[model samples]
Target chain A: MNWKRLAPPLAVLVLWQAGSTAGLIPGFKLPSPLQVLGGLADLALRGMPPGHRLHVHVLYSLERVLWGYGLAVLVAVPLGILMGWSRRVRDWIEPLVEILRPIPPLAWIPIAILWFGIGIRSAAFIIFLGAFFPVLLNTVSGVRSIDPLLIEAAQMLNAGRRFIFLKVLLPGSVPSILTGMRIGIGIGWMSLVAAEFTGVRQGYGLGYMIMTARDIQRPDEILAGMLVIGLIGLGIDGGLRLAERRLVRWR
Target chain B: MALHLEIEAIQKVYPSESPEGRVEVFHRIDLSVDPGQFVSIVGPSGCGKTTLLRIVAGLEARTSGRILLDGRESEERDRRIGMVFQDYALFPWRTAVRNIEIGLEIQGMPQQKRRSLAMKYVRVFGLEGFADKYPKELSGGMKQRVAIARTLVANPEVVLMDEPFGSLDSQTRNRLQDFLLRIWRERKDTILFVTHNVDEAVYLSDRIAVLSPRPAAVCGIFDVALERPRDRTGPEANRIRKEILELLHRPHTSPVTF
Candidate 1:
């Protein structure tokens, strides 16, 4: 709502338009903002490849991210709680996590395609890999960061092991878990786009649409696709922040 | 109902990196609290006062000791024993009333019953409007009140307080002391309170036990027979405070029997 916050980007856009008009910027390399906006209109009305609309591509991307990100949260949270709660579980799993964590999600694309073939499954698998570590590591740190005094206080109240885990550890680590989830989804969304670039069986994805645009030398459409990706990423992160605020209102 | 608590020949030793291989925090620390009596343990800093209370509360292990509750050897993690920590230790996530209900919830009491019971203490502690507020929203005095209410609502046989008001400003401390006295008078709960303030000990305790420096042990026990609402700066209270301070200031030597 603040005009001051809008000024910098507006000024940059004006300068970019001026440079493109002056022929100082090559249109073949990067299109002006107006060209990208026109490309967005073309994608919405005429479709990227004449029949596959921009909305369809967005839907496909969202579906893959949901499947992957959901599975990552389901697995990582409980496993993370165990690893954080018990040194035994952590000792058993930590080495494996360490070995796997540093490998980029894109690096897993070849193996994922080999395992699941060129479909949503391979794309989802890559996203899952991208999301898993952030959630897991954050959850571990969340549980560990709890003050020992709070646990002792709960114990003094005669809280049993189950009660301690459910009431104390779970609630105490929620803020950290939410943070990890936000980061995880961000990474997962990014990985989904990259995985689509490798190959998608359905022929419907933002990355694939951009690839088609590149094949036809449509730089404006490519930039438009990138803009959509950026905006959606911002929306997702903003939604997560809102959820975090609601859950951790005590802070 | 009130209960008698007896700590017999308690000792604590921690492993050390030094040549001695172990550090004796305290040795043969003995004390007893009669039913409905308020007892205070006052000692110098790092004299193992908090450790002693933790042992009594079964939160920490003693190298050697027996904690007898109403003449029976108390079991580990005794539910009948409750503690109020110096930092309040209120769960920041829970509201004031919910924090008070924690003990009852652990006992598997029905939600409605615990809520009503916790509400009663919220009023009793004068935490009326703040019952639904979280710990961060409350002041230090309010948080301590919530902490005390949290411990007391469960009706533990004996309450162990480790400097519960130590973090509060002087005025809040005095107000809380008076608040505690009123609650003690009404409930007649057996209490073992630990504090470093000689005046606080003199004001609140029915009996004050003084502990010497580490390898701490009870060096003196003075019966404060002063009347209720006793003036803090009064002659008798000051005299007893002076005596305890003198005992505490005396150089660390062999434990002296009073």
Candidate 2:
């Protein structure tokens, strides 16, 4: 009876619908739940006037997140590990990372769009900025916190520096790295929303859909877009959880 | 292939927080163990037994003096010394067999040979059914057994054990003591066991090295000379245990608690 899980939302929907019908709520400003659902169905079929389906918007948003998040991982993990493993590297890079870290992803939007220009590249660059630090910091701390005893044991067993790095350090930092990924993905999704507000030619993304619908005063379409964005985020996070279960089974 | 060790006046010092600019752990600590001998060092806490063991295994550097493993200087020695830390220090991510495979991995042994060698120790340690199990899945005693097996797989002539059974229950402690004795007898290994327990020292060691207080030195060395499967509750066991305890419990000039 996870219908209990739906109880609060259902109650809120009912209240909103009743309030709108009773003229307690401005009807156009806050659409009914049924109107939002109907809007979602219409968007699924006729494709939002530009002939782009709901699936097309989802794909565009999903691909942007994947590219940006992927690049962040590719760059950050190695950099983080190097910083953690070597004091020299950390001293060289840490101050720079700290300076850059406090700046929010949205603040970088104008410069990102300037560099990559109003397309998937600009959106992905913004998302990369969003995802980078959490992943990097967590990974660095993970490597730094590895038990010195384990490394000593490996050394006594005649393990070389490279062997210790691969066998001990890599596996030890995995759980923390996964934690970084989960957090980074959420921030990356949020950054994509802001990035998409800049718009792309011939592009249909849930964020772009919400922005245009807002300009046209279609609250129903905006709500539908929000619902889809939330559902996609939930699905991705759920998948990450499943992967986490396997990776950190030892813990 | 038992190995002999000569610990020549090993010492350690830490930078002090107090008025004394430095704290010497132990200095002029001299002891020698013949090949295949089982020696245990017992003392008050913070007497630096673990540090001495680490120095012997080349895990830590002594502030002064040196260690000789089978006539070779510590640095020149290969992976001939194995150390079993008090925490057991088994890698959580590795299976019992995989943990044993680590030493072989360092030697760049072929995969098939590594697996077979690891499986051999897995069976030797009676980890047959649990060979594939990760360290988290094993019980404390079993984890220690796996830790021992992992070290044994390295085929070191000398193994330094830092309170190998210190964390176990009394029954488990007694069981592991006998198990360790059996491994030493069968493998013909020289074991430098460090512990705080007098009974454990008297029960397992061929000789017990008693250290004085902080910045400790080998104050006395007592030979067990007891029979195999030594009685833990025997009169001689108590007598020697008491003698070692007395050596360890000498009145301290400083206000150090044991």
Highest-DockQ candidate: 1
Candidate 1 C-alpha error for residue A150, in Å: 0.8
lDDT of each: 0.94, 0.87
Ten residues in sequence with the least summed lDDT for candidate 1 chain B: B70-79
TM-score of chain B of 2: 0.94
**Which candidate leads in TM-score?**
1
Best by lDDT: 1
lDDT over C-alpha atoms for residue B233 of model 2: 92
TM-score of each: 0.98, 0.96
Candidate 2 residues B109-188, lDDT tens each? Answer: 99899999899888878889998888889888999998898888888878899998999999988888888888888877
lDDT of 2 at A121: 88
- Mark the regions of model 1 whose C-alpha exceeds 4 Å error after superposition: B254-258
Q: Indicate the fraction of true inter-chain contacts that candidate 2 also forms.
A: 0.80
DockQ of 1: 0.89
